[model samples]
Target: MDLLPRKGITDDEIGGQVARIIELATLEEKIAMMSGHGFFEQIRESGGRLSAHPYRAGGGCERLTVPALYFTDGPRGVARGNSTCFPCTMARGAAFDVDLERRIGEVMGIEARAQGCNFSGAVCVNLLRHPAWGRAQETYGEDPWHLGEMGAALATGIQAHNVVATVKHFALNSIENARFKIDVRIDPRTLREVYLPHFKRILDAGCASVMSAYNKMNGEYCGQNRELLTDILRGEWGFDGFVHSDWVLGVYRAYAAAAGLDVENPEPIHFGAELLAAVKSGAIEPQVIDTACRRILTTLYRFASAEDPLDNYSIDLVASPAHRAIAHEAALKSAVMLKNHGALPFDKIEVRLVAVAGRLAIIANTGDNGSSRVWPPYVVTALDGLKDYLGDAKVVFAGDEGDSDAAAETAKAADAAVVVVGYTARDEGEFIPGDMSGDVRVEVPQKSIGGDRDNLGLSPDQIALIKTIAAANPRTVVIVIAGSPVLMNEWIDDVPAVMQTFYAGMEGGRALAKLLFGEVSPSGKLPFTVPASASDLPFFDRDAESIEYGPYHGYTLLEKSGIRPAFAFGYGQSYARFGYRALKARRSRAGIVVSVSVINLGEVAADEIVQIYVGFPGRMVDRPKKLLRGFKRVSLIPGETATLRFEVPLDSLRWYDASAKSWRLEPGTHTIYAGSSSRDDDLLRREITL
Candidate 1:
């Protein structure tokens, strides 16, 4: 029998087949899809490659259907062998350009298909619940709207390949320590407003699958929670794709299948036996089993396999040099310029002293741990990039304590110092299982991840080294390397300049080589705010009183608490200056459209992201200080003027009014802002009197 059915198969045919399958299933067969087969250990390293065995050979098998489904992990980067390892999501998120994300996703999707694995089972858009959460670096950052926008772009990019792109863990799977069993207590208002948006966006983007969470929400297991699986996921968003359990999310086969899940992933326990068992026991209706089977089969068919109805999987364009160029470009744009005391644009460096600090100054400079910790043969570090670009300018190198006395000695000898500092692979990404195989090996998490980070600030050693270097050298530029936002309390005030280069991917070193020599202008923006101190907001760890236990922190609540961040979202600086003026906003029948004149006021060329935010003031429902409904990234040369337009569907301003349980739009004056950053005090707005 054909396992993969074409789309829109006759309703009668679908109904009939489901009925026949239901009638044929034994209780054991019905129970098969409930749970899966798993590897004996977390991971197995063989012949210089990693393989995840979801099933054991003796695992129960089912007779019906085609070959069993096999899948691998990833979103920020592909995990299948034979693909180029991209940078982590934290680094990608910093690019602040949605187009860049789409391009990067395309590259990832192409590479995954080329590597011979079906697409990533999940995009693991891990939301940032707490800064200290080990997996927080795997997320886009701490903002729901921003994560949603970027995640949506990527989801659409990858799933477009006919391979599934799974938007993961459903809700708050951020805290890794107590993830599996902890009851994540949260208020429904925040749940609908923030935590749910990214998942919703990914689903809306046509992702074919979703992974249930390992943790519980409001006194229930995530996989078993009907409210999330049925109510919000299916009820509210109208998601028609199949839902799979995260590794080990299922404890019972019949219960999970009856609970609205389609398949148990990784290891398909009992093979197809569980579904057959459910059928015989009468615990699950036959049609339900058939429907689940049909969904699974249909999904499997979408793959570029023998069963696939879509175009054959052949060469993947995403892995081509053209695509890596996209990643190279994004890795560059995601960079944020924190402090620029004219040590920027490095437009004039004819034979100046250049001293590089930290391991990231050259190759293998990226975060060393996690799924994205690529085993590529080559890498580009900032140090090597600088030396290569500076030509005859002798550049000094020193391993400054991550702040040691040795740092001071080196600083005293340079014409200028570019201190490269950031966490290494040890402190970030998916947890490494540790090599028990005799040879020294770094273990990485299989499926679920939780390794990295002991504190929120840089090591005292690095801070001390920074202070010494800053005091000794008048011109010190600290270049931060890492994937996520780090706390900058002790030494930020003393640095004359600072630049952040997230784990730059393949062409990373070469990109930095270009940026340093005035080859490319700096245009990356911050997706998340930098807190004045780690304590400026709620604890990065989910303390009993923090938002993780209830309502989470965002601009909306931050304002209520009267706490200000060191930097606001969408914030970035350019080599050239730009001016915003003459806001022309007109409320139309369709929605609200705003236009503004952005003029490049400096000598250098630059691209500016025109961000539009809508605020529902005095909102009865808890709302963000503003919601990013739309934005446009445009480029211009000096003295060039570009008029950018952004339109917000009236629905963008609507909220889930708890009282009515429907989307709400208050008939009040709506304020809109068109500016460079979320907290732009410089430009245009108009009140839409509805």
Candidate 2:
């Protein structure tokens, strides 16, 4: 990249300014710039919870004209004001549309700036190690490659507006319930290949900042882990941007500066007076403090001197009509129809009377209002969506919280029934409470909601209601409104169709209505595998104080053990059928180019996600039977055929050799599986020799 002077400061000028500012500023002013000023005071004024507006989390140097870094929490939307809430990151991952996700990132960045925030903590790329791990919705999915690609797209898009994007919960912070105290143990190879790869990808995309995770990796907290912050992220990866601790309690020691933590966010209990005392006592070097402050100021000026996104980002930009439409598009593409027996696309079934039953049907349920919450202007429920879509048709909605019999009777009477069931804030999401024994004691702002789920299965009552409804109505469709995969064994066989409409978003209801009525085809595919049983996944105990993280999880683990999943990763259904043909794979200077012709067989326009998984010949070493190397989403009309090409880099197929401590491409014939899902039967295989 060329380093010529643009409208902003030049590289030399930035360096000179940082040094000059450091010398001119008082020690107190430098430390003050490293933390929030009115953060806790504002929260206290709002009575314990942050108000629906941007909160000053860090950065303020009035002497140098450096604006206080106004930060907000999220992976959904700008978690402040009436921002347009798109689907959760998990939902966007399911969409598997990088371009769409980028566009979504653009809107989020635009809205964040409109809300007067220059920094965004919205790119959450943590791997979904377990479905029951409450904050699973905040991240992309279970696989590192998929998470990396999607996260990179988002980071790129957000930074396009010069809104310094921050990729958060830095390394191995998957579990929610015990995040504050959990110490995750993992081997170097597994950590590099599976867990840390995604973060590296985001850094490669030139993300402006990083927030250390709350949990400990190995024996040390992430905020103060010298190996992670200094040795790997800065020294090895060459991430020039600043690294900040997660808000409040994210930093455990005053010597965090020595470990490369550039800033302490929120009120900064650890890095304030304690840090000043440490410096005076010669326990910490003043050079370490200068380096930390310099990094923050350098990253700050990088965006501050750049051009503003647009003129006067008025309040109207937040959740405006155009943004809402983007939200609708996100929800439309993210809703994955997992199973269908010709029971979907309500218009095709000749239904005049419809029945909608569920506690979540008519509620303004978007997601947990913890750190990632977006208080939209309004939310449309599933019942509202169905009623609005059904217009003049008779629609019956029953929410007998405990009367399954009455709901069953209503289902029996309707022409077709849509049963909405799944977890809400009361069920799961970023667990903040240390006490999970029912008696709650909240000390400060919590990152979690109801905490990690008790189990993956649906509640007993919801299961019974689903079974009863399915028995009474042969044309029943189950709509799951969860953040992650929900095991559906108890009643999956009873229902003819199932759709995962993740905590869709503010405009989710409208999107759900559009999808069910054949106005739009369901194009989302499973980003993570839904296992036959929870036992098949890596052992996950959210409450465990210390946990060993294995190398494999999600589809990789299930495939390695030869255990079948309920629905394999990348599996989804559409009203329009798709056919794959003419599979070709060849090596190019760029990488392996795989081309395939996709045809829409049905009489409706739809999108098909073509996934390519590379399988190494021989089982001499531990490896996933196949790893997702590349994928593409193509749209086609009725009887339309389009050729889609995917570039799979040779590096993507390399293995992390623990002994060598580097990536190595084992010499073997690599088998490429090209088709819709991870299931072997669903793909067309072609072998390529290295």
Candidate 3:
């Protein structure tokens, strides 16, 4: 790399003005400026030495004679090393624990910097728009507010380790249907109110780049949409980071530049010397080119270290004791119990011949590919977890045809069967979208943002297996594994107990085992409702580009349509019986102060998730009948009383006054309901005024 110093500009000037780099770089070189280099080559070992090429994998693309920045995939876990393969973000969200997510991000950041990676694109804080979306496994669940807080926390933690976090797909990349062709038509209010808040939160948390998606938005490609990229992000929000395009989203370099995308990755896709030439020759404004380059250079300058430490060091990643502990804690907390018909907490000390079914019961994880992928050293499967706890009893492992016991062996010889069933890592949900085969070098895909799921039910094989297994074994417990809610219409009645452990992360296995034995009482609450079927919801497709949303798709709409969910949001079951009593609320100048006492009446210690839901009972505006105001997670011993208090601001209680076009407070009475879940309220009818 060679450059002639500007006559009057000092080195300090170069540092201050990244805009100057555009003046000196050639047209072709400028186009080359906005892409990235690959890090991981291959995941699984095949034959000879693990080879590294393009994308740090097999091989692709001839060199352009210009050096580029290097990047990799991750968030939930590191991709390189004999690393512990943790569950993706979707799994982390099911934990219903924000602090756990931050810790997960911290470790991931530590590993990313250690691996010599520059930027971790698609930090994946986007809200899940459609449950059937295949990429739903890669994103946080339905609520934008939750996603914003959790995603922002993770982004903030990752940046602390000196690696740049790139918040991804800018806007509405949720649906997988016709992603490349369909245009997502969304209302400005919904876009600003519901969808885009998480993005803003991520950027404010110090993310350095915002990756553009493959799809079109409002008729133009999101990658080069000026209104979205420039007007909203650069102009309105004042986002200062680079705008990188998804790989292979080609042929719109000038339009994209004018629109405001800074770096077109894996280059020549909408960016190259031709676009640069167009900029200088009056075809495209030089300011667009200058602004784009400056943004990228500004971001790149923050991480312009020439040294590569991970070039040599290889730690025993999966073997590290600390990593395992982290995984264990995450797994334990992530296990969310949806149904407990007094069927759990079985006589663990006396039970004999415990049989377990399903491959996931024996395997480490199911969703361990793509950006959220991780490399775990040792996995404690469901069978191993049960066996480890019940050393005196015979714990048999039966790999069911699906989630059920069609084989008849696990049940034929056992006293009780615990069926652990799930979708595979290679199944519908998520992937890095490249050749996982050792053949072609696979880098992150710029085009493959999402996909559609296969179907919503357990396969015919799994259904039949569960029915047969339940008939044989009277005391059977079913654990359902999924990234999003699916209908359990077939065997819901037969399975005495059921738990939804949605892709619990690396340590999930231990957590699952702990919950089963009442060692750790169930605490996690549902973030999204479990629909009876996909047809019941308004937007339940892979690609929901052109859907018109109102109160139907979201909680407000579902409540109006009288469509009952199989399980409501924030639904969970606990081993110990708990009671919420004496709920009181006082409204002051600041807002409302609510207090409640949570009593554990059962015989064992337990973790309780106390949720405060607020309802504007009368004279209010458009709101979700009630919304989650605050929640507390605590551990309680038998007969222990935990008193909890929370202060709510007036702004939090204010409603969006559409006619006035501003947030306004109305003189109205609101009801404060204290509950374990949205479906069931333990303490009711505490009033407050706003």
Candidate 4:
């Protein structure tokens, strides 16, 4: 019998079907449905490679006609081999284009489905509490509102293909090295206001599943934390989807199922037979198993029964030319130009020779070599792209960082010099042991694998290299490739032009070539603030056993401390100049509608991101100086003006009232600022009272 739901089947009908299937399932079958086959077994079968295809994790029972969830990891692209790798999540966040993010999500879902996967752990929305977090690239920005919108768009697009999208690392999962043992101490108000709004936003957007983090909140692991898994996620937010553990060590107790964890992924040492024993001995109720099975089966059947967007899923669709083009588009839009002194958009005809320096320029550095890594068929390096673009022009390249004098000599000879530098996978990524065993213990040394960054600034050698290259060549452009903010105070003033291209995917090199040669303009913005000093931000201890999380970080922290960032959040420049005027605000039925007229004053056509920041002036309660409430990306030609309006929802303006255990909207005069960046000088303000 086909378990796929027929067309037009209501959710209630699916629920009923799921209930019947659970009722028919035996105790053994129910327990079997709650865990994965085995991560090691799958790896062994796949010639010792992790996730050779999609990993099968529970719920396939022929007797019940319930389909199993084949899981694939992502946020960049499919984790499987030869899949298209788009720019990292941080890069996409810089673009601030929801439409582009949604398109990338659609490609991810299609590629995943074509590779025989139904569940995608691709929607990683963890807040970037600190740039030092090793896995910062997997998330969007530091703000909860921006994270929510971008994650929602991605989840929506993925689900459009009938593939289950899982928003992951549930709460307070920023740290990397000590994630397994770190206890994040956060007050109720701070938790609700700062870290969780983004997760709630995605849940409300109809995401089908959630992956609990490896870290602990308050005093308990997130997988088994009752307050997190049940009280907040399900009890308060009304999330109906199933929850899975992060990986092998994500769950510690067999009774995690009772705490609302539906599945233990990639081999459940704790939840498989151990959970069955707990149920039989009355340590845990059998009803918990039934509930988990019902949720998983319902979601699985619903997607399985839905009609696919394409007629057939072919392997050729994995990295199709069309999808690659979308990746290219993302790379183009995500490049953020931090500084330019009339040295950009290199004249292809006038410039006879170009110098490319640094090791990153020659290597295909996509992103962290962790779970989010996508093995595209080929990658275009900065060297390759320049050679391709400057067909007749001599493109001299050097990757030796130790020999800066030689590199500088090469730079001195060239008309323009491009120095590519930043952290690699060995420097930062998901912290995991290089070798694996059956017991989930680290058998081999892990000194060179993923871990949190110890320093926020570039290596001393990189700084010296930049200084040398800049001193030698008057026209120097430094392209920084990193997952998060890099302290550029060391050498930022010395360079004429700089751009942050955070792990731009396989097409990154080509996109870089286009932007450098005037084929496309840089339109991306800084998602996180670049503090002048590391001490100006929040206190971060990668090895801390216990840490307190406050409501402030990123631009909020910088604003609160009255510290000026080297580059403010939402700051970026374009070849075309944009003028903002006629700023206006009015009360709407929802909350408030803010409109601003923006015109491209420069001769070239370009895109501009109009940001809306809401400030609580003279408020009784403490709040950030301003919060990013709404934003829209607009494109304009020379002398063309467009009026853009953003609807600020009432819910967005509400502040969590810890006293009443509810959200309260303050009724008073609130200032609305419209600008390109978060800096006061970049914005024009208007006050509106509610």
Instruction: Note each model's CA RMSD in angstroms.
Output: 4.5, 3.3, 5.4, 1.6
Ranking by TM-score: 4, 2, 1, 3
Residue 366 CA displacement from its true place in model 1, Å: 3.6
- lDDT of all predictions: 0.65, 0.84, 0.65, 0.89
**Model 2, range 364-452, lDDT digits (tens) per residue?**
87877677888889888888877777763678885544888899998898888888999899888876553321212334443435678
Tell me the tens digit of each residue's lDDT in model 1 across 281-388: 786677676566666544555443323333554555435567666767876676777778776655455427677776556547555454444444356567666766
Off by over 4 Å in 3: 1-28, 37-69, 250-253, 302-319, 391-393, 402-406, 409-412, 431-450, 541-545, 551-554, 582-595, 616-621, 645-671, 680-687
Cα RMSD (Å) between model 3 and the true structure? 5.4
| lDDT tens per residue, model 3, 401-459 | 75443445568677778887757655555533434322235444433333567677777
Index of the highest-TM-score prediction: 4
Pick out the ten consecutive residues of candidate 1 with the lowest summed lDDT.
52-61
- Best of the two (1, 3) by TM-score: 1
lDDT of 1: 0.65
lDDT of 4 by residue, 33-138 (tens): 8888757766656665556868887687777677789999998998986899999999999999999988999999999998999899899989998999999999
Question: Best lDDT goes to which candidate?
Answer: 4
Residue 290 lDDT (model 2): 80
Deviation (Å) of 531 in candidate 4: 0.5
